[model samples]
Target: MNTDVDRVVAHLDPGPGPGMTEGAHALMREIITAEPAPAPRPARRRRPVLRLALPGVALATAAFVALSWLLPTGPGFGPGPAAALDIREENGYYVVEVKDLYAGPDRYQEQLRGVGLDVTLRLTPSTPSMVGSIFPTSPTDHRYLDEIKTIDQPGACEKMGGCPIGVKVPVGFQGPAEITLGREAAPGEEYANVTSFDALGEPMHCVAFRGRTVAEVRELLAQRGLAVHEFRDTNPYIDEEAASRTSVPDSWYVNGGYLRAPGKANLNVSEQPEESDAGGLRNCAAPQGS
Candidate 1:
């Protein structure tokens, strides 16, 4: 039965129309070569009609031939490759929505390259205040830095804890730019950027330890269930070995400090009063010492 169908299909002229695609040809071959079901027992004497089945097979072949012309051929046959970044065009700018804050820099670079931008993305661990902020890392092109815009939902950073949702780059930008974005620090991980201990929402937001003795600052930290992890000197020329000492004199003055991690602080202390109070330390006028 299959041999008879094949002979009929071979004789049919599919000439003078659009050429069938490879896919359509394969489909036609499959339909012609398919096995027929076993003949059922007839109640009365009857002959099998091959002519009746030929019309239906021919119709199916014609339908598929039409469909093959519509099917896209060559390289872009199916859905394009998935992108790591969700970039869209808005107001003459390419708005890039950050889907994965923790994704590797290479994945982001590849996606940006697809959009004809030579940009490098780096995600750095930061404190709560600095999280979701974008910083330009390119030293040479200071002018182009202002063109890249950081986008954030209004009042999201302070109220909803959702900030810096994406970034906007001008269209036709041919940049060899490098940018760094802030991400939440992992457990026990130090922040890449400096976070003031007296900054709003910090552990020591209202604490007044400037010009206070090291012994006094230790007591202040002890009350708040925090400990000095290390001591840093503000002066760059200070001896590295002496500055990193585990123990310092209690009479040393506390200049400023920053939170290294949760419950751990790095105090900037110095022996001289003049040097300790050099930096602009926040003055808490209210009921002080948290």
Candidate 2:
């Protein structure tokens, strides 16, 4: 019931994995001597970080993706969904995995393996080569999705050199453009992700979903007093062709100061927009994390 106890329990009782058996007293000896339990944290304090590089099959897929995909310009490339963004079973609970599509060889190489799970991202045979997304035939909408900047106002410390004059420039601030996650992953009940400009203070919005099934995902939203709707990448950013295939028109959550496709934040990757906003989030504009 407490944080310290929970983490301790995690390692002490990592759960009986599939097909695990004590080969002999030999195996048990190593397992028992593996490591000591860590000191428990107070029930009220925040713990340290969990992830820098994504974990699980995403890492392996990303390795191949990074080596094979480089800089993708559109969808249907980069291992063609090997490191799909899905909510899947991991150590008995559902966790998200992002295949290392763009990770460098030195990065994300070993940080993604889940302790007690043997997971891997699988791609359908029909998918194209990783290079296809990087060098799209018909220009794509994912060119500049992941850029962040921090700037200071130019005139904050400037004077008119002792002259009686005033300046007319504004101060500088740090702002991260909102990211569009829904451009790739759509929301579903079995697994759903929500993103907006306000997420942890940044101008990014997106949707990532992976669940037991589509219908099951819908039910979770209902229980939360939220309606399950469709997702549409019709904002200015999406390409015309791709937009046509993934629009959500009947849900809520878009185009406020926060969400680009406002309303339920339920844009389906293959539907139409329920409402529209000019200068709202667009799909074809750029892709975050390149």
Which predicted model would earn the best lDDT? 1
Model 2 TM-score, 2 decimals:
0.17
Best candidate, TM-score: 1
After superposing candidate 1, which stretches have Cα over 4 Å from the reference? 1-84, 137-139, 156-163, 222-225, 233-238, 275-290
**Which pairs, if any, clash in model 1?**
none
Cand. 2 Cα-lDDT: 0.22
Q: What is candidate 1's lDDT per residue for 97-216, written digit by digit as tens?
A: 445555676777776776677777655554444454443323343322556665543442331112344556777766766665545556776544334565443456557677888898
TM-score of 1: 0.59
Residue-by-residue lDDT tens digits, candidate 2, 78-181:
22334433223322232322344333322221221322222222211000100011100101222221221111112321110011011111112122111111
Off by over 4 Å in 2: 1-211, 233-263, 268-290
- Position 179, candidate 1: lDDT: 60
